[model samples]
Target chain A: MTIGLNAFLIIAGLLFAIGMLGVTLRRNTLVMFMSLEMMLTAVNLALVAFSRYNGTMDGNLFVFFIITVAAAEVAVGLAIIVALFKRRQSVMVEHLNVLSR
Target chain B: MADLLFYLFAGITLISALVMVLMPNAVNGAMCMIVSFLGTAALFVLLEAYFLAILQVLVYAGAVMVLFLFIIMLLDVGEDSPAVKPAKLSIFAALTGFVILSGLVISLFTDPASLPATPAFEVAENPTGLSANNGIPFTTSAKSFGYSLFTKYMLPFQMTGFLLLAAMVGVIVVSKRITETEPEAETTD
Candidate 1:
């Protein structure tokens, strides 16, 4: 049997939820950032699925933009994370609470 | 056959994602993320978005994972402390995630009617549902994407370029070694 739209959506939702779980439960900034990227890929999957099922190019096109934005975000975010780690000597989220103080 | 491939890729994606989240070692987690991303790229191929699949492999699996691994290795990241007894907050977070996942799955199964397949989906057995757009044929080829981006989305394209430039400058500035004269420059690196 061919895959259906619903199946694709469910997979997307599952990935998104897993990413969310990682974001909440994981304490490492690097892993947390990776989780964020997972969520973006999940969104990309959903968009491509919708684009395929709806017979339109909008979703696919938007996926490109999303990818572009995600790339920029990852670069900047990683740079900041590295700098933070260099300054603090730790990548644990709880240990980097200077602003909360 | 196609459904089997979908399930296989989906299984790979989901399992690797779970492992990435649950694994205590940062390096292992990053490796799992690579597998998950590759699985996603496979799914993209299944969906016939060949160009997107190629980009997914190149960007996510190749560049991004390499960058993550580089940072992890450069920092000499060690395994997370053993979590023999997880903290209370972690339990709550897991509960929240479970509730969300169950809610989504339940709604998906129970409300298929409200989420009924659209007419476009019904018009073709090919799953791509390649219906004619408003006077424009639709395809997922890289060329078609370029056409739309340059035509309908040109402004946004330029905007994304600017955004990338800003992010690049911001990263360089944030990571640069600053003089001790500036109070904001707290780190020597």
Candidate 2:
């Protein structure tokens, strides 16, 4: 039962769906951020798998840059979360109606 | 061997990813995400890109996820009850997922350009997967990736250093106080 790239891709697809569900259904800002990270991780898995299958390091290099971006994304995102939570005692997206007005 | 490991890690990754998404408690969800991250790193190892596999473990599972956990702990939010998804809505999501998975599986089977795994001589000669093409003496070791990173890819490599530096500055600016404005009343008004 040798592992196939298809099999790994299927797993990644499922993870992406879960992440999408979390993003769409959850109202909590922190939870949404976690879901976004989930999607990014799934993408990284796909990239590495592609790199292996193609016998090239290009995808791997891109994944490295992506990791850098993800780290930066989370840091700034969390800072925004903290600032928003300070403005309003809640981190719920629904309560951010201040922006809608 | 590959099939078994694939299934095992796939199971762990999927299950933990599900927990990460469905757990109402953000802290619990983040922990589950860490489990999922580790499982992904294990999958990378099985793919035989040893350098990438190690970096995945060190950077993602080690540094980044720990920071996420730290934020969760600092936030100190109580567990909120799971938000109920409407039955019809959940079914719609399930259907969408099924469609996407089936599409990927079909494409995987039909694509003619896919490489055959377990190529004997080719695999042995280019064990590190990159250096041989560029006339570097890889000698079937992990250092090949390092050589490529420092040599052929040095520009982007240095750019990554700059990117990290900018990220550090951005984090500091975003988190720090901009001005000592007079203390305003904490009002819900």
Task: Note the Cα lDDT for every prediction shown.
Answer: 0.82, 0.72
iRMS for all predictions?
2.5, 3.7
Q: Estimate each model's TM-score.
A: 0.88, 0.80
Model 1 per-residue lDDT tens digits across residues B20-124: 998989999999999999999999888778889998898889988898899899888757745434479786967687677858765874476857765333322
Candidate 2 lDDT over residue span B65-108, tens digit each: 77777776676653653463335776577567646765765576
Error of 2 at A78 (Å): 1.4
CA displacement after TM-score superposition, residue A30 of candidate 2 (Å): 1.4
Candidate 2 TM-score, C-alpha based: 0.80
> Which residue pairs of candidate 2 clash?
none
Chain A TM-score values for every predicted structure, listed in order: 0.95, 0.94
Worst 10 residues of 1 chain B by lDDT: B122-131
lDDT of model 2 at position B143? 62
